[model samples]
Target: MPVIDITSDPEALTMTVVAEFDAPVERLWSVYTDPRQLERFWGPPGWPATFALFQLSVGGRALYAMNGPRGEVARGAWEFLAIEEPNRFEVLDTFVNEDGSAIDGMPTMRMTFGFEEAGAGSRMRCVSHFTSAEALEQVIAMGSIEGTRLAMGQLDRVLHDLREYSQGQGTQTEVLSDTQVRITRLVDGPRDLVWRAHTEPELMKKWLLGPDGWTMTECEMPDAAPGPYRYAWAPVDGGEGEPFGFDGEVTLMDAPRRMVSTEHMTGTEYPPTLNDLQLYEEDGATLITMIIMYPDAATRDMVLATGMTDGMEASYARLERELLAV
Candidate 1:
């Protein structure tokens, strides 16, 4: 999807997505409207969704169900707003009842899809508009920032796959892809310094999650291998400020060389991310390569969009400060 000029007030409930497609208007429209086509390339990067049934007519309703990393299903529905083939279309998407009925007291979103000829291919935009800013605020309130980004990120793979398939036939033309977020860092410190910066609760509090109200409550570094280590951080937001937490199983633990941990966010029941941290000597400084693999494409994307690597950058910044202190 291409980026569009949006006039949403973040303080309210806002849902907007802009994407560009390299295919022609007809192909893009077909993929958007057809349930099978959608199922084929449905979802963003890490989170993939399956559309159960679809009918592209006024007052016609459709069902969509998305499966998450831990056997959880997220289902929703949409009613056709306007259906114009190969050009424009709109729909009202809603979270519904068990019998496939719309749920009361829930905000139904209006989504619009537009495909225009952009040079050799097309510029496609999908926008989901909400009724109020409160809806948007509620999502943030519920700590849904990461989940939302993951969902959108999953779309990247869908578009990429769609583009590659069409271009191979010499039929599809201008699919646009966004730049991926990459991380690069130079830690000018000793191996022990870096390890302590990561493992020790005292030092970790400075560079890791923090300790004022947010404290590293528990940490277990690998004793022999990676089997039994867990690092837990909790925010004392309400009572003691323990607002958030991430727990993981140590998959690999080789000091100053590589470390791997499978992490699940505190609020979530299932582990959704695998954290791989590699440390090596480059020139005179220590080089670290960190990779986070999600359970599915959708979850990975959500974390990316929520500035996951940005947190890495911040951690590095703090590491630099701690090094200077020593």
Candidate 2:
């Protein structure tokens, strides 16, 4: 019953979200593909949910029931029509009679889940096809829109805080010539996951650097905006660490694709770091390329001398491990 943003018209339903989580696609995919795991996080903010019937193959059914705060319950089911493992899933899901029968005069619908890599995390989009605009209206009215948002939000939180060891943190940026460092190693995991390691704070803290006492003090992504946006990672006062910190002002926020920013949106205390991150689908996985354009030869050379390629390889190693398990 919270504010539900209208994403599509009521008839031909379509909802698009490009959120970057702190985990790789494999981990994200497992949470949706594995029913036993999926049920654990299907409810909205305060509801506890459980899966009732599940058959995870093509043509199977994935059904779930949710218990509200007052103990009232609602049930839903998606008839799986296509299952492409971690890549795509199509299902005809909808509400039914309290007795579990298809409602006689209600909206019938089909929602498809598509997966692709976006910068530093997996981007999952739900394309819901309705029989009519009226049907689309009916489904969103039943909370499908907000429910999906909440469900995926939980996935992001889980991945960022996963028990996996924090691997690498803080790297000096630079421009690279394929040969100088002999350091370019093609990471086997998806590039999108690597993007998360760089930007998403919860994961970034584990692998990227900031002031010794740095913690993300503020972060925001406007639904639509230009020019200044903010990302603040600064040393925690009273914490035992150096007073290193950097603030970023938005150059771009394409979401799950790429983001460009200059240093310090709030003030100019810290030097600017020109950062560019890209994510794309490639042979069997995602390929991520990051370019840091510096002002002169000195800073670029200083960053290169830090041996970032090896640092990148080490952090990517953690990503590979998590994906294979999921």
Candidate 3:
């Protein structure tokens, strides 16, 4: 998980929060630019936010309200001062009443959000500058620090689900048949990036590792044609357990579209599984479908019992970060 660090100082008249995410900068920017996504995590625990108006352009306006307990509502408005894609933006925020009117003498803020590339992931830093020390203290006393932290905590999970959805990867598992199981996900980006990430040895080394302290030392896929493909992995520290590896033959191949392969995890007695992959493209996005077929019901159940899906989910999350960065 990424770390969320927040700090505020009345003497400085500012509140700043910083965090890193295992996602692309562009996807992270969507949380601020897209009102629907913004509403999902913009408020604290029980106080859900609702946006009535949102415009992502210079001099544009955003009107939103948060519903609190006992039928109370707090409204706010933001006037965009600057707009930059996947990078930074600035806005002037005003505390307002429920009827879209500003409260007289209420504290206002100038907020700036920054996004940058951090290795394979992205970092976000937000600063809220108040007009005076008294105003800053007032907001802090109103629970802004704790509320903002809670809201950001929810943002992490929201990004995970959104990343999977954008990639056309479904979060739910489907038992297609007694001997088969299917996993599907939607991926944002071009077909070439998706294809390369899925096939190329170096790119696969980046995202295909199941968990921490594990690395794929060797990956060989000389040709997409029906032949040999091998991948070997081991603990980074040369720990005690047995090394894990897989090698298989490509039964069929079609660039940027479909492929069929047979794969088996070594150091185990399980039979080799047949995997069929299909890719669909629509409006700059790709949906990847992977179907795994086992020889018998027992083998399929055994594989599922090993908690492979959890590892797959984490691997796919890493793939999303890689794809977006590309």
Candidate 4:
């Protein structure tokens, strides 16, 4: 984690967060100023931000919305107060409505961010000033501290070259919390092809098989949200483990970009997991980010213990080789 410390002062009516990064101040500043890069980690794990408007100059404003996993949205805006280039800046941040109007009772804050060189790396100090101690406490009670930590934790990946950061790494999994797990893999294919591989039954059957000597026995894809989809697999020789499958309904879909669905074992009563998958394409390759929300810590651990990451890597490798290589 990059966050070093977070402190709140009731007397000063403020909250301060300090974080250190392995990148330089200039590099850190670029990500914050660029809307595309900022959106990558502006919100927490499951709730990703999308910047609708960004004006990066003093007296300018920015509008963004954080989209939740269950089709919820929270809108916010920032008015730039000061700009000091690669070093510091200040903004007035406030909660807003879909129409860009300020929320009547929501608290607003003034925030300052300072960046400085720390040896070969850099350090960032952020201080947010509130109108009253109650305002600071309100935000704290809303999981702002943990949310900030998790959001900034995603910066390391944004700072590195996408290929250098994920290529040859196979499928990597990170436990965001007890019930939330993030899995990422870089596929050597365009985002459209990767999306097709996941949605088109013919393309999926070619690489969706988890391991060697297995074949997809069934694949029923949904046409859109609220539509049910199912997949089943079996041993090639019918001599190994018994056939198993998963069924779910596609709750949300943003073709070639994002999809959210509920997943459960075909014939089991276990609680379904929420699967949020997002794809980003750069340099002719796609980075797949999947965040799975489990029912509980025990279920998360049990699923991970089943060599899920290894199986995913096997499938992705096959995707690159069989489907995308041509």
Candidate 5:
């Protein structure tokens, strides 16, 4: 978690957030300035940002949209107010419509971002100035604080080299919240191939099997969004475990980059989980990030206790060995 503290002051009509990073001031500033890097962490997990226009100069405007897992979008714009190289910048942030026009009755705030060198790294202090206490309260009630914190928590992956940060990590799982779990794996393959391995039935059957002695018996891949997809596996040679499968609908798909789906166990009435999968390729390899939102904490715990992470690791290792290496 990069965010150190967040404070709100009604009298001052401002909300401030302070965060520390293990990178220098210049490095930290570059991530904010570069649209590609900014997109990686501009939004919280499961809601990624896409920048349509980024003009980094005083009086210029940047337009972007945060895309939700369920195909929802929230558009926003930033009008640059000040820029001081690697030290600070200011912008007027506003909620906007699809056409880039300000949304009616939505409050806009002036934000100042300051970067300074800390002991071995850097620190960022951001202050959002509101027109009135009511406006500040409104934003807080809308989850701005927690959203900002979660967004900043993703910065470490952006600041560090992908391979250095994730290679050999296998399939790692992090409990993001009571109902949310994030899983990541670095595969030694290109993004397109990895994406194909997930979406194509032929390719998926080659590596998606959790462990040896199991075979993918059924693989029904959906061709488009809102379509049904299912996968089933069975033990080979009369092995001990019973056959099992999962069925889901692909809710959103951005070819080779992102896909969102709702997953549920076949033949069961368990509540479905939302799965947001994203792929990022760097240095000839791809990083797979999947965030799963469970129905409740109990369900989350139940799923984790089933050795899901270990199964995923085995599958990913097989992906590299059987599919990618070949």
Candidate 6:
């Protein structure tokens, strides 16, 4: 579970729920953008939501109903106030009766959704604002917190299934030569965003760190021909030991199309490795291909034995999640 925080402040008339996902922002945003996917996890356990009309634009409306355990239906409507694709949106949400009319004197909450890169994935922050303290208390008494937690849990399952399906259908890898391996995946975002993710330090650190408890402390990418760069990492547990790090030089760069680099790790005995990455548009998605080459078969095998492939797969998965906000 990537979720870290869910806090509310009654005095402020706000309820904020924070969660993270191992998927791109667009993937998570689809929970609201796509009506079919939205219905899958919009309600708590045993209560599924069904949308009648849904849209993702300013002034657009979403009318939906959630069937209760005993088959009673609770209808709701949301009028979108603002929309910034793949990043943030604000909506006015209110409970409505079966006749599709807002319930008189009921609480109408203003909700905001934000998505940002957070350590190998994306963090989603949802804040709901009520008009008064009484209104906020009313919703809390209605079991809003627990219901939200359950809905987010369902969301985690949806993301898991999504990544599995994508891994089975969209990604491919193969051994190209005795010293090289090639990885290809159809990325969900734009080519420029993908290029920025690779070259920008601020974006790189968010997803490049292989797993939890590891942090990239230093990353430098200079703008120059044959750019020089360095990346360093340390364990978050504060264990007493030398930090693991690496440095490299960009051998080639062509904006949103291609890049090549020579990389060397601090503790590895293997010679410097060469990496070539290419990105292009295909069927409205970016097709990314990365070729990693070692000096020799022995060195390649030595690196592979260290579970480098597994680490890369994890990092790339994180990258996919981070790109959702890009």
Best by TM-score: 5
Clash-forming residue pairs, model 6:
23-321, 24-321, 25-324
lDDT per residue for candidate 1 within 1-326, as digits (tens), equals: 34433334565446555555556777667767878657533543223367777888988888987543333455689888888878888888787765678777676778787888988777766666767777656645643444444343333333444223222231111211232222335566666678667665667767775323455666665554446555666665554643556666676566766566767776676545655565545334554545455556555566667755556666676676766356
lDDT of 2 by residue, 184-267 (tens): 223445556655655555665453433233466655433332454455555666677434334555555555655555553244
lDDT of 3: 0.78
How do all models score by TM-score?
0.46, 0.46, 0.50, 0.98, 0.99, 0.50
- Report the alpha-carbon TM-score of model 5 versus the true structure: 0.99
- Model 3 over residues 157-184: C-alpha lDDT tens digits? 5576544445443334556557767666
Tens digits of per-residue lDDT, candidate 5, 136-165, equal: 999999888989988999999999999999
1 or 2: which has the higher lDDT?
1
C-alpha positional error of residue 39 in candidate 1 after TM-score superposition, expressed in Å: 2.5
> lDDT for model 5, on a 0 to 1 scale?
0.95
Error of 5 at 240 (Å): 1.2
**Candidate topping lDDT:** 5
For candidate 4, lDDT tens digit of each residue in 1-326? 88999999999999999999989999999999999999999999888899999999999999999999899999999999999999999999999999999999888999999999998999999999999988899899989999999999888888878898889889999999999999999999999999999999999999999989899999999888879999999999866888999999998888988999999999998889999999999899899999999999999999999999999999999999999999
Give each model's whole-structure lDDT. 0.58, 0.55, 0.78, 0.94, 0.95, 0.77
Q: Least accurate stretch of 10 residues (summed lDDT) in model 5?
A: 219-228
Query: By TM-score, is 4 or 6 better?
Result: 4
Runs in model 3 lying further than 4 Å from the true structure: 1-3, 162-326
List all candidate RMSDs to the true structure.
Answer: 15.4, 16.0, 16.8, 1.0, 0.8, 19.9
- Candidate 2 lDDT at 13 equals 54
Error of 4 at 128 (Å): 0.9
CA shift of 200, model 5, Å? 0.4
Instruction: Predict model 2's lDDT versus the native.
Output: 0.55
